[model samples]
Target: MRTTETSSWMKQLTSSSRQGRHGHALHLFFTRLCLQPSIHGLVDPYPAAVPTALRACAHLANAASGRLIHALVLTRPALASDEVVATALLDMYAKCGIISSARKVFEEMHVRDLVVWNALLAGYARHGLPEHALVLAVKMRGLGLNPDRVTWNAAVSGFAMAGNDRMASDLVCAMQDDGFQPDVVTWTSLVSGSVLNFRYGRARMLFRQMVAGRAHVMPSSATVSSILPAFAGVSDIKHGKEVHGYAVVAGVEQEVTVSSALVDMYAKSGLVHEALRLFDKMSERSTVTWNSMIFGLANSGHCPEAVSLFDRMLREGVKPDHLTFTALLTACSYGGMVEIGKTLYRAMREECGIEPRLEHYACMVHLLGRAGKLDEAHDFIKAMPVEPDCFVWGALLGACRSHGNVELAELAASHVRTIEPSNAASYLLLSGALASAGKQNEVFKIKRSVKRRRVKRLDGCSWLETS
Candidate 1:
């Protein structure tokens, strides 16, 4: 049922998906292979490309496309029964957030290998079902199939990411008892999970141990990216630079993930010049890399440059996501480019089809509010398709305080209270606006309410250098 062009598409897909790229670039490249070819009869399926195509779809989270490939694969007796194709199909289903389909595929497999078991185990681990991963591990052992390093690593990564440090450590001990010492992958998983869960201190300790040869594992490119965020979050340029040095020695400084994280680190830490220097030298740029540079520029008050860089990103044919829009909108808001912000908000939804998320909405409100358009911002919130969260209300409240709109400030603060009742921020904003308006009685009332509610303001962090 395949035409010559379709066959060529599969061949190209087979070759292209093997390239060291992930996300939208790979997704767009393989989308051509997913065109539904007519299969009303015995279809001669391209088994070689089928697995690669499915893997690429998984990376894109394109389940619909994967299902179409599945349909095509099912049409061929050879592909339907091939273990490699079946494993790829199952892996695709699992990663595409279709766990039920993945399980069904596993059940139907006449012979499930360690790879099949690990695929299913990893699916459960990565998808917030660490318990399922453990249970499946036990099930694997019961079936006389002991889990390998990959299996244990997947389980460990899942629990670590779920913020269950005790269980993840227990698994590591269990793995050692089973005569499989943790590898670089295992350490990287732990580091990544710690960073993601906001345990930066712990992440740093682990990375130190990793590099000290405790596990005899050198930090890979993944380990570099994972550890960069831990340093970035704390503005620890000293440590970030050390990691950067390691990356250079490791020959992964130009690797996209490492490069993106480095750019993000320097940018977030207020070293835009260093970040820009690295950004320009990268041979390949992912969306994260571009977003980081734009954000760095915007935050450093180079608003026009941020917008210009975003335009360049579009010119380079890179797909922009919601974060991209948020950075651009933030630049517009900070620079008082109200019209440009509105134009971008419209273009995001219309041209890019990125539905304005809560952050996007907050950015737009911030833009309008900072421009002294309080009534318009209030109207925009009322018109939002989805209910605004605390950030959205807080944006309006902060703007109200800055622009001295006590009445609208009261409304925004009340919404913030309803959303995050314990947060002292909204009440403080309302009090500030009332104080600015010479309404001492109103400010006193807010202070009394805060005391009555026993709302505690968290200690604020400063980005000032400790050195």
Candidate 2:
């Protein structure tokens, strides 16, 4: 016996909730629904209303509001018994970062399904409890619940997060053996995991397999974005262009993430012009998009272009973040535009209100040091609001080496050793400075120190893929 007016209001609430408005706004709408007085006073919401309200709570990450919805559902047996509502409640709690509460709800559910189990598994994975997630996956199998693609994806991601790439790859094999084909989500998880663990070679191999349609699934935009770093790592411009061609054919070139990755790949691979062309063609750009282009231009020695693009970004009303200023300062430092760097440093605080971070300070120190202003660089380090890191001291030492200032080099090297005792770079730089100044005694002392400390120098390696 629903009144037409009440039914209309319910429909409007449901529609509005599903319209994908902001979480807070949806939460307010749900709150209004709870407060609305019906003929019998504050009426119980419809069972269908529970999921939408719970979603709002999840979006806002508001556990308090979620608890209220839980209480409301408890009073209505129909809503309480609804599996969809129960699953939504479980997901909401999990997403709100209340894994224990999510587990409690999962345990209380009378009708647990694979979706419910996956939700809990993803909760553990998301909360950095990959071990717990894997154990639960085993228990889930023991209970005769078959793992689906989503389930395996979560498990793969969990292992990846745990830095167990071997186990992650084994799981993919097991997934294939279980008559389940890995989808884009599956490959993306593995690819990103490999990247995180610094196994870029294996990541590129995986990307190639995905592109060859091993699983009979096309690579998604995320898949393309994830593999760009591998090409950048090896500077494999050939493979990068191949991927770029695929993106164009797939019509995903306009996607912000893919475009950003393309720009970064081209820039890192020493093709600044190609990167610029792609940046210019982008119809829409995010802050990251601008940062990537500016960083690429700067990194590739086009400092003037980087500075000009920063100006254009400002003119277009796009806000520059800390990374933007860091890139801009880096370009000025490398180009010997000392005055421009100083001006931008001041404007970062006064105009943009961004507090100078350690990276920004490091760039400034490097800039002044590279320009042979040893005393100014030293003063800048002393004037730092935050403590100067090894990078600042190292910059000063390198500059001293260049300027043949043995005394200042010794001082900078001492500070650097104090900050990072085992770092071979500091000793090597000091040795170079002493050797250049014909101080054979100091150079011998540095060599003895290196031998005594057993400091191993990290080897530099580059990769090139051949067809």
Number of the predicted model whose TM-score against the real structure is largest: 1
What tens-digit string does per-residue lDDT give for candidate 1 at 36-92?
454574445455766776788888888987898788778788889999999999999
Clashing pairs in 1: none
**What are the TM-scores, per candidate, against the unseen true structure?**
0.92, 0.81
How many clashes show up per model? 0, 0
List runs of model 2 lying over 4 Å from the truth.
1-113, 126-128, 462-467
Please give the lDDT score at residue 55 for candidate 2.
Answer: 82
Residues 76-166 of candidate 2 have per-residue lDDT tens digits of 7788888999999999988888999999999999888999999999988766787887798899899999888888889888888667888
Q: What lDDT does candidate 2 reach at residue 85? A: 91
* Superposed model 1: Cα runs more than 4 Å off: 1-13, 21-42, 233-235, 462-467
Residue pairs that clash (backbone atoms under 3 angstroms), model 2: none
